[model samples]
Target: MIGLANGCSATWHANRIFFLTVAAYALAVVFAASHWDIPLNLRIYSRPFLLFGFGVTVILFVVIATRVMLERPARLFPTLGRRLRGYDVVNRLIVGVPVALTLPVFFSLFTSMKNGLSRIVPFYADTTIVALDRAIHGGQDAWRVLHPVLGAGPLTFALNFLYNVWFAVMFVVLFCVTFSTGDERLRSRYLVAFVLTCVLLGNAAATVFASVGPAFVMPFYGNDTFFPLMNYLQATNAVYPVWAVDTQRMLLAYAALDGPRPGSGISAFPSIHVAVAMLNAIYLWRFSSLLRWLSVAFLIAIELGSVHLAWHYAVDGYASMLATPVIWIFAGWLSGLRRWPVAATAVS
Candidate 1:
């Protein structure tokens, strides 16, 4: 127990923002479980935790291997040997491994609890969100407008691929930011923003809004308003095989099960996918012009894909894009507080 406390303390000192975020997530889970009678399922998070662990381990190995390869042949093994013996490497492993492990657990709980609480509230904002979407798109679905230009076989496939790749992209960004011995300020900023976005925007805002998005509207609300959109997507899936369609179906089916399943959680007021993409883009803005532009393009693509794929309403993406910047700014301020001697002492 003392060793465990020490380990946790070290982790907190290394990444206070992440630890705090996880604590907040835990409290939220407890509150939800007590109030809503939501069961906490540790089993659901096991597979995803394993997958993320494996992926991050491979990525770290590749990065280290690439660095070793870049060295002169004469110095390669020596350099690798030195790095392996170095205090920095050992310290990073000691600190980073636990963080990497805990993040997925926190995320799983956040998602699961959010999904359970969403159902408990029993107030879905699908109609209101769709109305907002139509209002913004001049009384027409955004997909209808975008379908003509981007609904082609190749573009649809590409968009679906890109949309689905958001998870991988997010993981890469997260792994790099969390574990890489890069610029401390940049890393802290990104980490804080990410936590704030997931907890404050992704879960909290989603709970307040309580929406099921475009994809689950029919099943949840019996509203056929999005049937035309769904039918169009089914046709596209027939031709090009969009992954979002299948994922949406799977999530809906899981949601229909008896109780809170491990990976089953759904709410779609402000699209967390777009919000995270936008958050990353905002942070990447300071890196370089080319990266900034690429981030912006990716953000736009995600926004479009979120709508066109029928996973979200147009307004869902809009709200996410708008809210993300504010959350980023707030996170920045919170990160800045870490610089204070008092804050540093507290973490220590």
Candidate 2:
């Protein structure tokens, strides 16, 4: 019992330390970039909004840690013996390691590791959007022909806007499910496998497309809401008290990255937001009918939002839809180890 508690406590300490470090580095890079006016190897690191977001993130982290820390495993499951020892280690690791190690590495990879993008896109254009941009913005009549049915009006337009909410909803659900169900081995396994998939999908989409998104590529498409907020974030510096009321802050938190301009001229393809919501759907499909319908709704909104808002070229959505199933299958394959456990521990 004493050894398990010490091990779990150590893991928790390591994770909290890493999280604080990542938050600090991200803010330091953003602030240094903004004030010094020097090119920080990564483009996103220099913006004022990024700096502000980092500060806010630090505060939120502390609050969440304080709230959740009290319920730490040793307190929750008092009884322990050799039989339950293995699970105690695995459970603590799952809860602590993903928070401490995985998330920081995942975010760090994108902010610095530009080479990952280079490695994958060697066969394709440096960024996949060049040909795509021309095809849609070109004098092609096929886009116009296809536009009418996909365009947002009173009927599907509200549905179109809802995709924005779904992605956030999905992420919050995963965070809550994994963090709250700490004692159940089966539940924890599902949470780990699914959150890992969501995080991977997010990074992969960012690497594959390297897009700021249509909200930035060409903001006039009516969904200028996402673009303007991002534009505010990329060009600004310093967090203001009133800035908390600013819509752009929420937009940036939800969005993986922002573009150079407030609107028009950023990565605008493969709608990763859509991809994430879809991934959530795949995980929840078997468990909840509510999620299954939400997933279908999410995809439809994604298809319409991308085209109607002119945020993504039609091909981007099509590509995302095609790749989603493949990514889901791959993530599932990693989690196939559950039938036979490497080790299992029960709590009394």
Candidate 3:
């Protein structure tokens, strides 16, 4: 611990705090890694994270060493030297959050890849898909009208991504971060929560529910509307298999031609898009009541788009959406336990 002129460094000797934090973080990383189950990708991301962490630690030590050398003892102890130490813990916390979140989901998924879990029914869950199919029975007509409009033009296709709602939500989150207190410790915590939740939703989507969207699988009409967008993504990830699969699904969807495409019998149930969007809505509410409403609206649009576009069954959207709000509430609760000192100071 460092000895300050008049008092203890408020953040010095914070090692114990981070030890607990890192332990919790390690557990989450394990969960994520097992869940994502992708080894190659995990390695690809970890290297940069490690490098960044190392660079930050080095800078922190340099600063602390300089402080210890120059800082004088209190007037009462003029003959004594001031010592600077234990500040590196802060740097560790700074980078630990994301590492904990991403690595675990990736590992957890990779771990489960063998049970044929990667292709399981949520990727392949049966009963859930059946329930989704049932909902499609009554809503098909209502959806047909909405679906065509969504796939009709670039404007509609852009709207299909729920850009308006998300764009609004992003600003709300940004503003909250901007105005948060001087302390970022807790803000970073919640930020990590959101990042992990979304990553989990995406990784799960990739592994469990790889549905070729309505635009691709349904033969209702020519998917020229959204196919172009899907095609662009395909071109974007021509290198990565994960991306390649997404693009192919879109092409398969374009080929399905809009009338009645075969939903990837293997994928469907639990719409990831809804899960993620709704989660964003839930977390954004951490900022303001206005954000809550925006999230709610986005939730609704994402749900509607899922079915109208036939990328997901109504049941799947409902299930995925449910988890989102639940996860958001949890994330908010945990974040609430701590406050951003910097954020609070700034706001004050």
Candidate 4:
């Protein structure tokens, strides 16, 4: 154990915090699985791992090829060789592959556990959450407010596309942060925040709230509270394209057929989509002003899209916006607690 700890301290350095966080998260996932009687299926992670690996590999290859072509045009092979030999390149591959694999593997298990446990929970809080949404929106359905300005048109289509892009955007950010050799502190902070947001807000909060959101409310409870909003989305789907409609249908189908599978889980009290986007925006705010603003805009679009697309109440997004920053700040504090002096000594 001492040797292993010393090795991790030396090899991972300050980034050990992320590894430790992942470890703790994995343990929690295991406990949840056992407690919830959810079966562990490693196969659930295969597709996601392959997709993430392929995307990261292609992006990295393009970046390196571009640099080699532009900077060392005359000696491309030599430049490429040198780049491959660099510590950053080697470390990124060595450290990144494991981190990337770890995320999906453990997260899949966690997600399965979350879905199964959600079913065991006594009640769905759709009515309470909907009431909260109404209070916040001044008794107006959020989609109604958005439908007027966004309308069923090109803008709505674009936003739907962007909303679906969240999956890719999230993976890209995780890839960048995990593979980053330049900024250890930043990387640690982001990873910690990401894990905490998913586990705390996505899993814990959702479990406690135990609500299915607007999309599933009618199907699950036969409540027409959000029927008009769903009708509006269905109408928009006729003219423009909304991916959420299809996704919600698929999710409901999966829920009915298989209960809860790897890539599919249903809980909507505080939208993880919105929380993650806001978390990304907060972290980006520390780096680039432009990227930060773009992230915020994307977050807003996600919030609006969640409502307009019938996936969530407006309050779901609002709660996420309120919850994620506290988690981010807490992650920052936790990352700061890494003892660099002890780590250096142990490594030496």
Candidate 5:
């Protein structure tokens, strides 16, 4: 451990808080699995490892292509060789492997935690949140309010497509941050903030609030409060692929299983999807004006998607957007990160 630590970057050391956080969360996951007799499968690691490998390949290809284009075409092989230097490769792997490995474990455990939530605390918050959603949206379900503009089948389908885009966008950010060679302090803070957002808003807060969103309430609790919205989504899906409909059905199936499954967790309140989008926007805001505005636009789409797609109430997005900045600030403080002025260009 000391030998490995000796060659680590300051940025790597700065991620100590994030490392410790995941370690602690892993412990909790283990305890929960043992107590519940849930199988902790090693195979769960394979998916993330494969994804990490693919991302690394893509990054390397992009770098090599850009360098060869800018410098000399003949240096392509040499560039690849130089880029694959054993020490640099090993060093980055040392720094990045754990970061890459965290997702599968984090998500698998998150699924377990969310699945176990209702067992520990019955979901009694949905009906109440339904009423609260109406009151806050001027006595109409938030989806109804959105129907005037977004009610069209093609638009609804487009929003659903963008909502699914969140996963890819999120992975890209994570991959960049893990492999980033610039601004270690900033990277550390963002990493810490990202983990905190998942644990706080996604896990702890979700379990406390414990409400299935509009899509699942009817299936889970026999409440048709959101049936009309679900019907509309289903109708749109029939014409164009509103993938959320199928994903929601899959979640319900996973929720029924006795053991934890990959990508099985589901919660409505304090939308993690929106919170993550907000975090990405805030972090990238300092990089460049283009990234700032693009991320901000994505954030808005995610909020609107959450409602129109029937995955969350308006208040879920509202609460998530509100709490994310607080978590980001707290994470910054925890990491002792200082504010840096915006940069005109992003680091390569």
Candidate 6:
């Protein structure tokens, strides 16, 4: 087992870069929020933070209690008492406390920056992305190619459901990693990669490649190139409750408002949905083969939904698929982590 000093040093190394990165990004978000006159409402943002924090804590407790009860029914309470005092639990506490601070601040700033995008930089990439999408899809939009098969009301609704499920899956993964007793090196890498993926691709590249996506093309650019797809979705909504259509309308409303609301933002190009899904897949690949394939399938579905739902161009998912691994590798390198020896007991 590693010594306390070694563990402490490793923890510092694991989190050092993340802390610095978040601090720097927080300042950047504040500057952007100021530019848009969006005040950071701790009340608005902390609600999700508390939910995730408490939700995950309760989940961990239940899982631990269940496992202990199953294995040693009479010793459940005693086992929990001992395990709660164990180093693994201690490690989770170390990570959890900081995450409690970071998560809410991160959410508030993320919403602010996202809501401020149009004010900061008008979307001018839709036309170019549209052309590139057609070229990539052999002279037709990606949705048109997929529509022949996935355009039915049931299929559209299913895809929308899977698309919306991305949020839950994202938070589940976040909490899992935050409280995980797995390999500390990998845990740290995943956390770092997660933040960078959102910041670099979600905010930075999004600003550079601002596009309103297929659904908003008419509203933002007065272009009808995607009108067919949008019309099909609207028609499908009459039967299937296409939530994305309503969500898009809500985001547009939020964008028009003076203050940032939760989940208020518009971005297309290098889909963050696809990017984070791929990141999860990459992180899970090492643990379980079944989980690996499941994540891959989920990633595929998310990419398809991004296009089929008119939420992203095909190339946006393509960029995310391509760039996520590169960012993961860069995060691993930046974390200064070496592969944990297979025989080594994970930080506990």
Q: What are the candidates' C-alpha RMSDs?
A: 3.1, 11.1, 11.8, 2.9, 5.0, 4.1
Alpha-carbon deviation at 99 in model 6, angstroms: 2.1
Give candidate 1's error at residue 261 in angstroms: 4.0
TM-score of each model, paired residue for residue: 0.88, 0.49, 0.47, 0.90, 0.88, 0.89
C-alpha RMSD in Å of predicted model 2 compared with the true structure: 11.1
User: Per-residue lDDT for 260 in model 6?
Assistant: 72
Model 3 lDDT per residue over 282-324, tens place: 5566668986887788777777656654455566777776666
Per-candidate Cα lDDT values, in order, are 0.77, 0.46, 0.46, 0.78, 0.80, 0.83
Considering every candidate listed, which one attains the maximal lDDT?
6
Query: What TM-score number comes out for model 6?
Result: 0.89
Roughly what TM-score does model 4 have, to 2 decimal places? 0.90
Task: Encode model 5's per-residue lDDT on 232-286: one tens digit a residue.
Answer: 9898888899999999999999887776676667789889899999999999999
Residue 305 displacement in candidate 3 (angstroms)? 3.3
Identify the superior model by lDDT, candidate 2 or candidate 6.
6
- Ordering by TM-score: 4, 6, 1, 5, 2, 3
Lowest summed lDDT across 10 adjacent residues in model 3 is found at 5-14
lDDT tens digits by residue: candidate 2, 1-348 = 976765555444323333443455456545534553423243332353345335544665565555555545455333333324533545544554355334423344333333223233422321346355456657442234445664323433454447456645754654444333343433344444444333344434545556544334332233343443334333332331222224334443433443222211123346555666666666667767887997777777766655544455566666666767676565445334433432233222
lDDT by residue for model 1 over 1-348, one digit each (tens)? 976666565566667766776787788678877887876765566677678868777876677868778775677777777766663665566567876777767777776776686656775677787787789888998888898898787788898899988988898888767775546656677787887788877778888888887788888888888898788778888888888888888888877665556546887878888999998898889888998998899999998888888888888888888998998888777766657553443222
251 in model 5: Cα distance from truth in Å?
1.2
* Residue pairs of candidate 1 with colliding backbone atoms: none
Error (Å) of candidate 4 at residue 6 is 9.7
**RMSD (Cα, Å) of model 4:** 2.9
